[model samples]
Target chain A: MTDNNSGFSDTKQEIMQATYDAIQQHGYAGLTIQSIADNFGKSKAALHYHYDTKEDILAAFLNYLLSEFRETIQIDEDSSPEQQLLDLVDVLLYGPDNSSSEEIFQMQTALLEIQSQSPHKQLYRDQFTQIYHWLGNLFVEIINNGIAENVFRDVNAHLTAQHLLLIIVGGILNRHTTNSEMSPDQIREIVTAQFLPYLKK
Target chain B: MTDNNSGFSDTKQEIMQATYDAIQQHGYAGLTIQSIADNFGKSKAALHYHYDTKEDILAAFLNYLLSEFRETIQIDEDSSPEQQLLDLVDVLLYGPDNSSSEEIFQMQTALLEIQSQSPHKQLYRDQFTQIYHWLGNLFVEIINNGIAENVFRDVNAHLTAQHLLLIIVGGILNRHTTNSEMSPDQIREIVTAQFLPYLKK
Candidate 1:
């Protein structure tokens, strides 16, 4: 592996983007190196040369999404805790638009599918575990800050955080499984309008 | 197909039990007719006679679980809405013992795998949709009653119910993905002790 500027990393990003699109469209079971190759107009052998196996590609895909999640997570320090919370919900529930949200829903659904598998379960466990804790800690910080500022009532910061995560997580699962109609606005409305009231004075 | 008695139904139960054991052990991807056949002393041919294809068996397995879930859901009308909520949390998180909760975890894991597939999506959608509505409606009623009785904070019952579902759903996803130690008791405690306080008076 020769080190180079953006050339190798650029190919990697292209591979992952193709993967994300394929998985969203066809799912993990339906996905193959050939399918990913189809997106790039490359042969399956070319895909195999870049990545040895589907597992290798998937591992990279998971890493790609994790990096994206970390990069996009931004919270303004000076904002009210309530505003911060809404920001968190916005990041979790939607992206720039419906199209991005759809991609996210597909990404999450794909991850859950992989997470449930025994072989990948151990492999991906640590990364997701870090994510779980990071979010939990963020919620705890928000709650504690809110209490300190006296804008919200004193609630059990840890439990409240877990509760919020639960709803967000549950909402994510529901997006794929439920037959109900859910647009991006509906999800945001539920988060800010319905779920947020519990924390508000 | 001739109408039969308990004998046929009992055979159906046994087959589904085998399917459950196989899925819990091997996961949906690793699931095979042989794996299920291994559960009973029955051969693959015998299994095929009962189920034409692996899809048939999985479909049956899903239906069996759905019926079991409906049968077990019971509530005392006389109990306070708070008690009802706790009871709901308890049932969702765990059962009388760890084994049952473990089984529930496996069942959910299997369903999630099938759910990610394009073919099985429609078959499972109606059943899951009914379940989503049933649980949401249950939450709405409970919240409405709690506010009426002055036992809970005046929260938007519909949203609150959805939030509660979120925690439970998130917890389910966490059960498989997180490496954290969470027994049935710990999960129940988190729900009752940490998350429950916000709604109670």
Candidate 2:
């Protein structure tokens, strides 16, 4: 009998969720084993039994995020490639949208800091590279579809998709940190307007 | 007599330059007073005489970068606003190819880290806000010019410029981090191709 002993995977998920919550409230600098354990109603020793250090917890969380993203974008068997690509974008930019935005931002910030000093930085870098390549392939598919449908001009599909993916990510980063009086709706309108013309068929 | 004894203002500039070089070489995690002092051939005490801590050094470097960006994008008195806007985009996306791109990437990464914790994050945020508004104003000028010249379609200039900036930053960042064998030239060509049709006069 153990607090997290339903299963090993269950235990890990519990701790990860707790750590994510703490980070959302207090930022990465506020992430500590004691704080996490306190939030879990356990002692730091119990926390250590499962994960050795703060970095370990962060690595596990990063793995979860990457896996979720990859799974989110994986194509279904019967879906047209265009639909798959749109699904991928929606999953990336508009996930559950319930409890994830601040948590995702905090995780991004924390991982960036970890990547600064740890040998594990390569782990995250590899994850990003995989996502980037996947995005390139998705763009190539969408551009081809648009041209076959005669919605897009005869242009380099690879380059067009790459540029679009960049705008999506970079636009979100800019919008996330911006302090302008622009409402969220306004920002979305701007992003959609910029993106639709390129995506339209 | 003071060591080096360049006037106080020059001394400040020297320290800021040395600090930028040191921090850029060794990221914030490894940055130290000793490392910066060594860069300048001065004692740690001598370096601390100007700035109180490593954070101070980092902040000074950010200020230096902000000023350099401002200078490059400054609107000239004689040029039309349209020309000034075009020049600003050129300066931002394709500045002198002489400098190492790593330095620019490091500066951006460092700013993100420092901003997360610094009280002066607001100051940096304000600078970014100014950049956004300035870009918006430039787009407005372009739209007005195009309308007068009967060249452009009925598009919202401010919104279009905002999106263009997003895609441009995104493409540059993707090129910077990935191993896609894509060059800056290719990225810029794609950008010009996509936006030129929309900007016809």
Candidate 3:
């Protein structure tokens, strides 16, 4: 079933899912191509035909995750600027709602392992920079709207956005390094305590 | 030389430094025991004599770096609390000034590579947690002193400390990801725009 109809080959997707499962079971260092091949009851040769090395499949998996990231980064066009801003905050801090905290923690840790691969660092940086640039623009628009509506004080939207993004990344980091959540309460308290200084008197 | 002094033999120090230099040159994924040996003009057998595998040497390299980290984390006892505070920020963000920005970038990237190794993650976590914990306590002391002196508004020193440490780590992350400096300007702006809410207002 290479594909009845789709953008990518079905066999490749299946292989990547198997790789994901291997990562889940074995952790990054422990995963072997043989284990991934075993997931589909396929021989190790089946995997070797499609991917030449461990890094090859992991790189493809990163591309898969990045595409997923792109898809989720959007917000409805009609939401109020403040709602849009809050939505962005939620999306950045929380992984997808479907994941259990434990799964989120493990998957994120695995992603960090992939991201740290030496040769692929620039790839990670490029993807990260793109996401950051998008967030920065969204923030600029939100701050401008807030200022116009008298909801936020006059501030440098770019720098403030950069600052908030730093905190958000830090919060995301906690999820991986420990299973710590950027729980709704933490975000609310932070925004009020930290962002409010620039938002209102 | 092994008996000159100190607990570690000179041979061990040479191996660790060779490993450090290998990481600095090749990033983590590219480094091997052979590559590390090449750094010191030693044979792979020399490395094999001390380290059975690449991870063994890396674990040792990590311990070396952690000890080095501990030594540099201190500030002068005579400095005022405010200067002490700034110094902490500088140390966390800038790294040591002697290394070029590119070296700092590569080394931190290598650290991320080590931090992401799944088998050794808890080892890394323990080291990182120790560092963060120390910074947190120091921040608590600094903030409490500032508040007592009426230089900072009253805030929950512990939580505030945690928040600041998160930002510092995030700042440290930038050095690796993009050759970005957590410049003095950025830090000053962050303190004014972000930390000031918790400081005198």
- Judged by DockQ, which candidate is best? 1
Provide the overall lDDT of each model, using Cα atoms, as 2-decimal numbers. Answer: 0.72, 0.61, 0.67
Q: Which digits, one per residue and each the tens of the lDDT, describe model 2 over residues B119-179? A: 2256555556665666667667766666665666667777777666776666654554445
Q: Write the per-residue lDDT of candidate 2 for residues A101-187, one digit (tens) a residue.
A: 655555555544443333225554554556678768867876687678776667778777776676665565465445665433444
The better candidate by DockQ, 1 or 2, is 1
Question: What residue pairs are clashing in model 3?
Answer: none
* Candidate 1: tens digits of C-alpha lDDT, residues B98-150: 45655677766677666545224676666567667888887888888989999
After superposition, candidate 3 runs with Cα above 4 Å error: A1-83, A118-121, A178-192, A196-201, B1-18, B34-57, B77-80, B118-120, B178-193, B196-198
Instruction: Tell me the deviation in Å of residue A62 in model 3.
Output: 4.4
Tell me the tens digit of each residue's lDDT in model 3 across B1-201.
Answer: 123233457788777777878888887778887789899788998778887877677767766765666566676768766677877887665577676757766776777666666324565665555555666788889888888888777777766776676566555554345434455457556765666554653
Q: Pick the candidate with the highest lDDT.
A: 1
Better of 2 and 3 by DockQ: 2
Looking at model 3 chain A, report the run of 10 residues with the lowest lDDT sum.
A1-10
lDDT of 1 by residue, A125-192 (tens): 76667677888888889889999998867777876787677667767677677786545566566667
